[model samples]
Target: MTTILVTGGTGTLGRLVTERLRADGHEVRVLSRHSWPYAVDLREGTGLAAAVAGVDTVVHCATNPRGGDEQAARHLIEAARRAGVRHLVYISIVGVDQVPLGYYRTKLTVERLIEESGLGWTVLRTTQFHDLVLQVLQGSAKLPVMLLPAGVADQPIEAAEVATYLAELATRAPAGRVPDMGGPEVRTFPELAGAYLRASGRRRPLLNVRLAGKTYHSFRAGGHLTPERAVGKVTFEQFLTGRFPARG
Candidate 1:
């Protein structure tokens, strides 16, 4: 069985990826800051050598949205090289280069670092996760009125679907920078919010606000969408139903 190391294996995507890898009869090592023996902070990167030792593939799912992604990636690259890692699989956003947000910019920077790290690498750019969209809606629903960006749309793919694909990629030869993947449908902010409200049986006044900023403008322009490669089978409605089933 191939030996694989998954960083941030405790997170949403990483957890699923780890499960898929293990199910395929591969030896999977989970790297996290809290775990013993394999615990190592990617940003600090102090003890990463031990975690990466004898690892054939390293799936980088650890990311810091607030900051420090570049530093973490550099340290991980060095450790992977030292451990003789054959494949470095990375998950990135679809419009990382096109979006003007700071987080997106950082993701783009990490992608560049991996490409030039001199190691075999595979980077898959995908649209937003359904979980993130649901989180945004849940946060907005806290207030009496839900405020959303006007005209913004998201093709929310299931996290499990992405995880399975990552596991499949890890078991093969490294394919650098694969084609973008997206969900089945591109639903607008209004539609997504309405769906969440209906599914959760929550009532709130909805207001679509046109915010000023290059980032929001880019989102409005669908910079983060991949309609051409909509290969995902699960729809947002189906996801909601799974989360909140109807009473018989």
Candidate 2:
């Protein structure tokens, strides 16, 4: 019964990780901003020491994708070290090193911190989640016509699958930088958007617009894809069907 502290325990992946760890009979503490039992903010370094103390491992699922991820990771690493944490498991996105996106850059920086922190650590880089992909599609569908970046491909995995893997990593002895995990299949943005529209019973026209920038170029080059590591079982179509069975 190892005691583990899971940061961002209320978020999408974190919540699933917490549930899986608890189901395995481990003592799990959840750190969130307003949640009970444990309340901690990684960005401000508040309530971190208390949440980390006496924990056997720290699973870092918390992230600020918009900005400030590096500072938050630094604070968490320092707190974990002070608490003498046995292991720190971090969840990162696939292709953080290869992608030129700002969020990916921040994740890469956090990976470096964990590597040089001298603490027992494991970093699992996974592809984007189905939930995130759906959110993006839903947001874009609001336009007059659904517009997608040409040649951009995504390998989106289920959040629950990633959560289960994270729990496995947290229990085992720390292994630095595990192999990347990706969805079972890779699809273009237009394909994904069309699937979403069909699943939602909306017949929105999709226009593939060629985007110009390093970000889109990297995506077009498959920097965000790990074809060899497509280990997830769920596909976008399956996810849509599962989520919107009536529409399907």
RMSD of 1: 1.0
lDDT of 2 by residue, 111-187 (tens): 99999998999999999999999999999888889888888999999988999999999999999999999999999
Q: For candidate 1, what is the TM-score?
A: 0.98
- lDDT per model, in order? 0.93, 0.92
Question: Model 2, which residues run further than 4 Å from truth?
Answer: none
RMSD of 2: 0.9
TM-score of each: 0.98, 0.98
RMSD of each: 1.0, 0.9
TM-score computed on alpha carbons, candidate 2:
0.98
lDDT for each residue of candidate 1 in 1-248, tens digit (9 for 90 to 100): 89999988999999999999999999999988887778888899988998999999999999879899999999999999999999999999999999999999999999999999999999999998999999999999999999999889999999999999999999989999999989999999889998998898899999999899999999999999999999998998889998889810
Minimum summed lDDT over a 10-residue window in model 2 is located at 33-42
Kindly report which residue pairs in candidate 1 clash with one another: none
